[model samples]
Target: MTPAPFFYSIFGLYLNSNLAIPGLIVLPSVSKVDVQVSFNEFPPALQTNIELKQKIWWVSRYKDENDRPLVTIWQLENGDYWRWEYGDRTEFIIDRKGTQIWANWPNNLTLEDTVTYLLGPIFGFVLRLRGVVCLHASAVAIEDKSIAILGPAGAGKSTTAAAFAQAGFAILSDDIVPILERDNHFLVQPAYPRLRLWPTSVKALYGEEDALPCLTPNWDKRFLDLTQPKYKFQELPLPLGVIYILSDRTTSPSAPFLERIPSNNGLISLISNTYANNLLDKKMRATEFDLLSRVLAKVPLRRVTPHADSENISKLCDVILEDFHKLSNNV
Candidate 1:
């Protein structure tokens, strides 16, 4: 009798890499990032294993051209992973093997440069998928319940999340809060231990903003390690209390401050605010839509039109807190 092809679990999802692709083995270790992939065909790269800082489990496949490399970085921490593919003629599968880094880079590009460029986005995407549904907006916990502040890229999501963090509410997730359906309830998961904020918002929140770690030398964004300050980075999931879709009302100053949209409209709003919809296909989109519809059925949804200024943070938080309290008491 033949044995089962693959067997593993991450964040409760059963992974069968061998079944999905022949000649692939994904082994993830506990404590520190360490992953080992065994390919029946390709031999291990000799000098490549020395350069990695951590070991991450990964799976890769040859594209139709047999030159492009499609890779997935499986980081054991938080049970997260990401899938990416390089162009034809070069393929690299970089992952952490415990504290040591591992890579399968094509001979053309230097391994160091590829790791540096792909690490952040790949990590971000992995974290986003696992528990945090990276939204294009910010999130705040009000009265122990999370209120998502939704909007476009520069619509102050990070600003709002930071302000709420400063105002004593725990930061549930920033940018993305993965919304999952479990027995009729929606669970929001925090994406990462750090929050990436624009420089302007950093200065606004911390005053002398030089303290934040620069993600890139010239980029306007910085990464703040929330774990350093003892901010509760939720490892388990939390029920999503409210969805507040934020829209800048500077152009329409006289419009109502807040309005409750229909559940379907709210679902559309939530879908529009997703951070990685581009990667989703029709089937995935439908699945997400179904999951979101069920979520909206339980949680109240609101549309908040606020003037894009400093004051918006306080006002929005205040309103959300009030609503959260009302909901909790009723529940």
Candidate 2:
């Protein structure tokens, strides 16, 4: 069956996907040429027996006994990816040109589950193949520039960015913020305006656990929709300002503070916080490192430690905004 063409706006690119990506911000129409997405059947064999790493029920990357990454086994030829969720399965065949997604899922699971895995790690790898540097960060537009908040899982990156919107700023993205370098300046590619938050975060912000719609029917996670024009998303890529890596409060409860990360420590922090770093090969890692070196020279790097008391969220945002404007003047 030929699926109806679907359009989505994300990662500063117009996507034409044959399969419905329900999570993305669907576009009614677009005329630009960008990446094409399609769904089709996959090959019948594992590309190679060699295993580089095995992730639980998600993906197992392959490499030979010599520690060399296995080349593609597809007739169309690029590489192969396999994913499983509770025995429901998916296979991806992709190259720098585009991607073809195929899947089989149990009736019990929701389509959101299928699409999440499809777009999450799988599409992240796809972007890397296309030479785009992505980060596991959330970003917000502060006046004229973008500030990306980087941290590990549960570091409150999304919640803090959403707080910026509450403080009269616009959001650039909630997760997987894409950073690009052009014309000798780093730019932040805007993502969908929605912010996915946990139940605890939802209660903390709105005092209501159901303040926002859930991302999936079976999930407790809710979405912070910023569709109103006043607090709407930034549609275009804005010049990068600074990258702040958030840390848990290990200090006494004074106030949230920002500390600059020296140039020597910048690359190590970025490599650790980058999106899809685990999937990169040797050459890709070198390219990513080179790009970060140039980006750090232009964009400031800092470590942000929030106050121990959750009520200090507003104070943290105020200080960060002050610091962001102060640094953006030079960028």
Candidate 3:
């Protein structure tokens, strides 16, 4: 059956797809506890399951969602079928086509993160078959250009990104940003509207008592809802600009510093910062490597080591912005 079209704008990368299954069409709800989702492929099994539940929130589990099995896998005739449930109200089913992803998500929640996670592998398959590339980094667009934050898990990538957002800098993505080659230039898209911060970090940013509302209840991570209208959450895509690689030096008493590095060096540093899940197959790793290499070649990279001081977030933001402005002027 023909499905209704749902439009999603992530960092300016527009995706228009249908949000319907065989007997079910998931629509966005106005409730705050509602779930948003997207799917790449729709399998009959998924349709049947959703039809049975009628309304429930289910996302990928992977120790992220109340320890529930977030991802459901089913073997299909053409390829493997994967479904991601976001809590109890949203879900997405994908058909593992070599190049195309029959993807769709709930309109209520931003599907940026879900899309970015799948885009890497989906695009990787396309690029390897067609010889293209992708990267593992966080990107934001400032002044119509995209700037990426690259680093390891413990690195302050998300923290820095949140600081920038607080300073009125529009956040393009939190953990992942897809770099697509268009018109002989690179275009970055937003990955999600939420930033996952550690509870302690959240306390530092919003204050211990203040950050409580943002906490994910029993979860260890605190989610900052950038989609709040007050933040003026931006959905537009910006051009690619600067790349900052984060490092933690909180144990030291020194102030934060930003070091400019050659493109090759920057690329290597980014490769080291990638967060790879254990379930990712070899093909996924190869694809990640290719994408990281391509991104490094196109953008200027910097290493940003932020001091571990509890009060250094604001200061770190200022220092990074100064460097960004300097680079902007030189460019």
Off by over 4 Å in 3: 4-6, 11-42, 45-93, 98-136, 209-220, 227-230, 262-264, 275-291
Pick the lDDT winner: 2
lDDT of 3 by residue, 218-316 (tens): 345666677665553446556677777777675565578878887657656766655433334567667667666766676778877888786788888
In model 2, the number of clashes is: 0
> What are the per-residue Cα lDDT tens digits for candidate 1 across 244-302?
78777564554326778886578788789876665554655676777777777788888
For model 1, the superposed segments whose C-alpha errors exceed 4 Å read 1-135, 208-211, 249-256
Ranking by lDDT: 2, 3, 1
Q: Rank order by TM-score, top first?
A: 2, 3, 1
Number of the top TM-score candidate: 2
Error of 3 at 153 (Å): 2.3
What's each prediction's TM-score?
A: 0.63, 0.83, 0.66
Tens-place lDDT per residue, model 2, 178-262, is 8888888888888776788998878777788898788877668888778866577888899888899999865566669989998
Off by over 4 Å in 2: 1-4, 39-98, 228-230
